[model samples]
Target chain A: MAQSNGTDVRLMKGNEALAEAALRAGMQAYFGYPITPQSEVMEYLTMHAPEHPGVVILQAESELAAINMVYGAAGAGARVMISSSSPGISLMQEGLSYMTSAQLPALVVNVQRGGPGLGTIQPSQGDYFQAVKGGGHGDYRLIVLAPASVQEMVDFVFDAFRLTEKYRNPAMILADGALGQMMEKVALPPVGSLPRSAAPWATVGKPATRERNIVTSLFIQPERMEQINLQLQAKYRTLEKEEVRCEQLQMEDADFALVAFGLTSRICQKAMELARQKGIRVGLIRPITLYPFPSAVIRKAAGQVEAFVTVEMNAGQMVEDVRLAVDGTRPVHFTGRMGGMIPTPEEILAKIEAVVAEPSLQHA
Target chain B: MKEPDVIEGMEVVYRKPQTLTATPMHYCPGCSHGVVHKILMEVVDEMGIQDKTVGVAPVGCSVFAYDYMNVDMQEAAHGRASAVATGIRRVLPDTYVFAYQGDGDLAAIGTGETVHTVNRGENILMVFINNGIYGMTGGQMAPTSLLGMKTSTSPYGREAAVNGYPLRITELLAQLPGAYYVTRQSVHTTAAVRKCKKAIEASFRYQTEKRGTCFIEVVANCPSGWKMTPNEANDWLEKNMFPYYPIGDIKAPKQ
Candidate 1:
């Protein structure tokens, strides 16, 4: 694979970018069960994973089993990854919570599809609350990266690993079915010869110098368990300081700003361009990290903008966070499409136009 | 002040060595889990593969078997140990991988996974314990429960009208082309315990040689669930369970 110039030209779907990124980021094991829109990732890994030393791949029995396999492999300190759609990802919540409580560093890719039930295989961002609020049980957080472009899909996975290891927490790449299926030109990263760090706690085998290490989340005592929870909260606090990321476009002199992430961010960007052409001074705040959410950036933009229009593939999930970030300093509006439907750039532009025309109509 | 008591001294010398960890087991007293665990450890010691072997513990009563077993181990989700073991063995082909599962975990929830894994000819060992009931979940009727056995959930004694007949997992698995060895053994008596150990050792040997998927189903006794003494449970297993479930090899690789 030849390295291309670092221009964000694209020719890959969101799922493809994730697969390539896992390979580039030195992932050694991939345990996955087939689910819609995310199946390509497993197919890609099955073919290319073996070329790299230490790469272990398997098609697990179920989404539940796949995540548990990830837990097992992650416990052994192998750079591991798992991918699924919304419903499948839901089944993995128990194992994900276990991973979080155990502080097991791993990557989870959710190519979200429409859902409340087995909703459709089409694209939707309905998992916003699930991802940002820590879908599984306990007072915990997963470092979530919402990528809007195919290029960012590849880049964010590499970033997810770095952040996961740094915080010892599970990191997620939240993409939608459109991003997963749509193809675009992507400049691949140059494969490097860097030696990866070996986790001392991973259970490869008991080396002569160290005692056998057992990775588990079962704490019998309440006080000791509470202490673990407190430690996890502290780690998430430190992560918020070091990991929050986002992209700001033309927010300096704007009357209204658009906030979005993942596939909707791309549509919002296009909407912003069209709104600018129409002389409606609008900008965008595209979140790169959904968990250590880009709150400060939004707060800063709130001072300069009169109103904020939050656009998403789901119905008003991330808008809540945007509202909290502005903290009533300015008006906030929400527009979204659920059930695997993508709101067009024209639709988003129309919503922005409506928000700017009647400032009093903005949501609190 | 007294001479050595030869009989007591000899008895102490011949006792089974404690290979399992000394932690207080959470299993109920008289439960067959301890007996099965002891036999498995003895087999590991006899085969001299404790260093190279890796065990996958399921989410049933044996979820914490890894905590006691003196080897590299992973805890798999309920009934998914075979799939997890498949992942471990594929990556570390030289390492012997085995999954320990219960009847509810194997024949009920994990049947599809286990069947497909064996059909794929994964070279791993599977140790299934069939106690005709779900002991961990308070005596629920399992897929292997006898026709008229009463359980907590089945207070009216399992009837053919409501519940189906017991499933013979060894017989079911033996029909698959990928399954190289399928056997049903028991650990109710001292003689049967020795046979169970030999069967476990043989399964591990099959995995080491890459023969194919080796399945050993142990007809264990859940005395507490059965509402019987340990000895009575053994007798009950011999009289009631064995005739129906039957003990013997269903399939073995040709020499």
Candidate 2:
């Protein structure tokens, strides 16, 4: 029996949860185009915008327009956000680079679908490289948060806003079709619980008290541009030191480890449990923040585990990061299903067993 | 203490608008961007909306517009100024928002944003500076480049067979219901400068009235891009560009 607190704990699709969280997190404006697996985010915001006074929801003409709108609203010092899937996210790379260059704080949600070119509307982690590698051009990094569940889909939205504002850079909530469309119980924050602090640097009609502020990414002079790039690199280093978050499940006395993130992490967890039932020592490392890769944890675990097996929905993206973290102390194995294919726990378990038997595959 | 309006025997009949920043503009000599920037800032000054105006600067020659415009400004990507202005205006509806773009930025790469922004009736002012060439990138042929005109990209004169027809985007946008006021003006002479100033002033007023989108296209010239002296460029503009892109209001608000 549930308490009648006006459906305080309600089952919600991950996309809906993300939209609800944005409103509650004091999102001032939302500009997005309709894209697969994430269009519900905009639809929910539009339908419920009336409940949140002064909240602006607009369906932009295209992803390019949507991203620029985010840039514009962010420059005006509003808590703004944009959501899109794979193909749409590709259109936003230029805008993302500009936002990062200007050091503007905003949120971008990528509910990823299979892609190389409009591949499928199904779940896949192919965008892991694109998200963490500064998908846009130039030397820039976005604070990428991987939410593995519907609850996290709601929670990371709030985290993204806070982190982006704190660092004065953009942040991304990287989910997938599975997490976006799946339904689960989530506790949405109370309305207006999170009030964003005023951004003094915002260009909202400069007052006489301060010199007018300019939000721009164009530093024409080569020397000046280099200086700006250095400044951005320094900020990214600080983020790496302070914001690396991950979940280590049942690592104590484990001889093997499985590393993954987002939806794949959930699947890996099930596989770990299956391996444990077979009298095998297996652990799971779920990286919540993909940008500041949890290298230290994986490196430390490498000394304890004989081998690591990475399971993903992509051809093999995050596996590279896993291999880099291991640093040859132990062999790192990878098993992936591409083009919108989900690896069953049994398949992942088999890979773990194979890695455990070989311990060091010559090609690993 | 504020300086006296009258210094010595000089009554100071004319002076730079306070809304125009002290930063030295990087525009080439005889570029219409400087005049347009001055006139637009003058409107911001005279209307006393300097503190309530947000400007969006486009990528072309005026990419450094934020350095010259005293008001809060955002420099948008090439051709994305109108979309950026839409974001700013929606967030701060009370603020007077405007986007300044060039022929290449507006009529070429940003045509989609410009058309859609006006179609949605975004309550902002869009200032288009059409020089018929890409000034910042060293005089490439722009979408608004007159046919038979030779540019870097069209070295052998723009042929109708090779290059598409010059786009009359201003007239095309005027047909949209969202365009509350659409006009084309220039700053070639004293009278033209005054008319261009009035158009900008009215555009801001219409923005405050929530009269959809107010677009003003200035048929200007680029001396460096056109490979001509400043005076030659102005003369060329009046003699050549005018015949194709006439100066006057193409659309106006109803009483």
Question: Each candidate's chain B TM-score?
Answer: 0.92, 0.97
Stretches of candidate 2 off by over 4 Å are: A1-7, A359-364, B1-8
Every candidate's DockQ is: 0.30, 0.90
Candidate 2 deviation (Cα RMSD): 2.1
Model 1 DockQ reads: 0.30
- TM-score versus the correct structure, for each prediction: 0.91, 0.97
Off by over 4 Å in 1: A1-10, A192-195, A206-210, A359-364, B1-19
lDDT of each residue in B1-255, candidate 1, tens digit only: 123447645633343433456666787777778888888877776777665667778877888887777667776666777766776676567777788899999899888778977887788889999999998878899999998899997888888788888998779899999899998999877888888888888888888688789998989898888888888988899998999989989998887
Candidate 1 retains true contacts at a fraction of 0.12
Score each candidate by Cα lDDT. 0.83, 0.92
Q: Model 1, A1-364: lDDT tens per residue?
A: 3344654344677687779778878888898999997899999888887677768888877887788778777766677899999999999998889888878888999999998899999999999999989998888889999888788888887888888877889999999888888887787664542235667765554433544455667665899899999999999888788888999898878888999998888888889999999998898999899999999999999888888999988879999999999999988899989898889999999998887779474544
Tens-digit lDDT string for candidate 2 (B98-169): 999999999999999999999999999999999999988889999999999999999999988988999999
Error of 1 at A202 (Å): 2.8
Error at A323, model 1, angstroms: 2.2
Model 2, span A65-86: residue lDDT tens = 9999999999988999999999
